[model samples]
Target: MSTFHPFPRLPIELRLRIWSLTAFPRMIHVKRQCVGDHGEFGLQYMATSTPCPPVVQVCQESRRYAPYRRAFTTGAEPRYIWVNFESDMICNDGSHDLLNLEPHQQDIQRLRLPIDDELAYDYITIHGDQEFKKFTNIKEIHIAVDLQFAGFSIEFLAATVNKCFNGFDNKVKFLDVGSGYMMDANQLRILSDWKNYYSFDTHGRANVDTFEGAIRFMRILDNILTLSEMHAIDDENAKIKQDQQFL
Candidate 1:
């Protein structure tokens, strides 16, 4: 009901600072959708549940200061969503092609992907690890998992991590949509150091539909993966020692 008409009279530096503050991080959901029909039916990059950056539509001054750029192009469509690679995260549902983002791979700093076996196989076995590695600036890799799924075995999860993210130095985290906690890979390793870490009788089964329960489910998976890696290393060392005995 009330408006500040004199706001424009404020200092230019102060006005710019206000606009800069509006540029916050966002979770952009990207998925492939069927566009066109009849003569031309194809999948294109679609930003679901995301709106264009407000600064881009506020005014000419704000638009000029906006950090977003149109990215994720294809042969049919050259432009898609406006993304701030520095602060905004691109969340993919594993249906879109990673190669479509090759042009801006170096600019993306944060990415979220689903922890699905088929998706992992596509990236590692079909597409090859080099394609995923093109996003050279990634600082964090968030793996979305569903705690309710019974098929998420430790061996499968470890294989996915090893095959897809073996040499990645970036932070790997696990997130469940139903949970409030986001567990870091490093913290999982540390927590697994305790005795009887595999015992989760207090937390119940992984299918418990609760926030705290979801976190406990994810922790169990992380602990198993950590132990599996340690065992693999021990086996490798034993083989090397046995070979040296013969020499």
Candidate 2:
């Protein structure tokens, strides 16, 4: 009898899933290699005013993930689509451009839009914004970056929360304030003001004021406990199912 070695092969979907699992793993590591590596332009694409597509391209290229880069690097629509949603992030250009598209083989998982103009966002929400509901399968989202002068604005944050959660009244599970340049009471309120909101990641200068000493340290423990609870329950269920198979 000849011993056989199983060849390592992953289905396209599985391979894509694995890639996404670590897609932005080093989210905290700011890659400063882009040309305008100075001031606000350093961390973002100045012209595009959007971070996801370009950031993904740069990182993918940095890792020599060329082919994958091209997969999303092209096409006018969904230039860089999140696999989970299979929905291309759309900029709020007066119309719900992304929502018009029909779902393909991949399931629509999430949706994102910019918090460009604060006033408009407020108007939409205050008037019982039915517009946001167009995002059919939205789940996870990245909204108004809080970083000013270079950071996300307060109005933008409020509107983003309202738009993404369908209302500011709802609770959001995961949120990233991300290197936002905090100044003034209004700016701070956006992060601290929310109710039932968890996870305050103060990665930028403003965070210095918010997360001092034990605050960050204790938060780390809380995160670990949450992770343990989630996984322990899943592991127990798997074990029970395995025993039932033998019985």
Candidate 3:
């Protein structure tokens, strides 16, 4: 492709807008690595899959437009990860300590974590509910289910959700990593109630044990949350219109 010689002559506002448009959401995987003997001083590092945003290195103007910031540092050295907290989703494999991210808790909006025995014990049973409150601005929590532990009871899952992410109006999604199927948390609650009321075996009836079954189950919960959100907006608009008519 030929370079446009007149590109630099464009208005500063237009140039900035173009740079802003280049910003896209990213999924950054973070895990703690044992850098010392006996895993004494573990350090969290970004996986090779996540690369630095190109806009940051393009030009000074583009760097200014990019929202990426250096975060999740160990403080022992200059090592850190470039994070676009507003749009990037941090995928933690239940290795890094959540306390390490407390500095930027309010800025991180999206997070994906594995839900298993380790997570349930650490975050729910051991730390209790207070540890999760650090993320004040969290909007979405993606809980990846570990299919290896097929005996996960609905009570345990619901308790984990309520204890770890309670009091927040964030969207919760459960992802079966083996099948890459995602389900809404509200739908899971409904399923739990239906199972209890009808005396159905939780594992046998849920049908999320197999890949094909998980995909079919996820389809039912896919747009349920989105449709509810649309109805909420319509109700708010109607209320506003009714009040305006009397003015």
Candidate 4:
């Protein structure tokens, strides 16, 4: 008798389930990358426990079940993806046109947008809307505003919100202000007005003034984002089950 490898004989559905079970945690960091002077663009994710999981690289069958680089790559429509902006000019200039992400990427259900100051926010406002309108399935936008930047302007909040809803016809489910500087009375009023006007859910630190406050605020935001991703995944799984039953 010959010893056999039973894993390979498993059904594709089971294989995928196993792969998903072994998947690196869903909450992941993503960033933009450019290659060559011609400016070929690509998405890069922060290193994970197994950046290229053995499942993906092991064999053709298992590879099909592996989540490829696109899963969390910049333009890939991953389930839950986080992008943190610490600088106004770190990646692409706001003047740069939004990259043409795949339709699924545009349909990301959960997103953690960057936290930037006035200039960076302005850049996004000027150049990011066109790309944002493509996000048809966006359910939530978690914004992390960096309070350390003293140049934050009130206009950033309204402009960002408007851009997100511009052509999507209010498809977004929530506009969460996850972290930012402690708002003055006026800013708080504006935030209140927007929440009412947009009729969307929000969660975040209302006040973050000191250095210690900023650090603590970030930890809280991270936890919230993680929970959001978990909820989204559970919702998706439920939906999938429903669809399967319908079929």
Which prediction has the highest lDDT against the true structure?
Answer: 3
Query: Model 4: how far is 10 from its true place, Å?
Result: 4.6
Winner on TM-score (2 vs 4): 4
Q: On residues 167-240, what C-alpha lDDT tens digit does candidate 4 reach at each position?
A: 54323322224443333222333444543443233554335433334335445544223434646877999999
Candidate 2: clashing residue pairs, number: 10
Candidate 3 lDDT over 86-139, as tens digits, reads: 889987654435334536667789987766555444554456467667877888
Query: Number of backbone collisions per candidate, in order?
Result: 0, 10, 0, 0
Q: Write the number of the candidate with greater TM-score, choosing between 1 and 2.
A: 1
In candidate 4, position 96 carries an lDDT of 39
Worst 10 residues of 1 by lDDT: 187-196
Candidate 2's displacement at residue 52, Å, is: 14
lDDT of 4: 0.45
lDDT accuracy of residue 56 in candidate 3: 85
Between 2 and 4, whose lDDT is larger?
A: 4
Model 4 TM-score is: 0.46
Which ranges in model 2 have alpha carbons more than 4 Å from their true place? 1-108, 116-129, 149-177, 180-247
- Candidates sorted by lDDT, best first: 3, 1, 4, 2
TM-scores for all candidates? 0.65, 0.32, 0.73, 0.46
Which lDDT values do the candidates have, in the order given?
0.62, 0.36, 0.64, 0.45
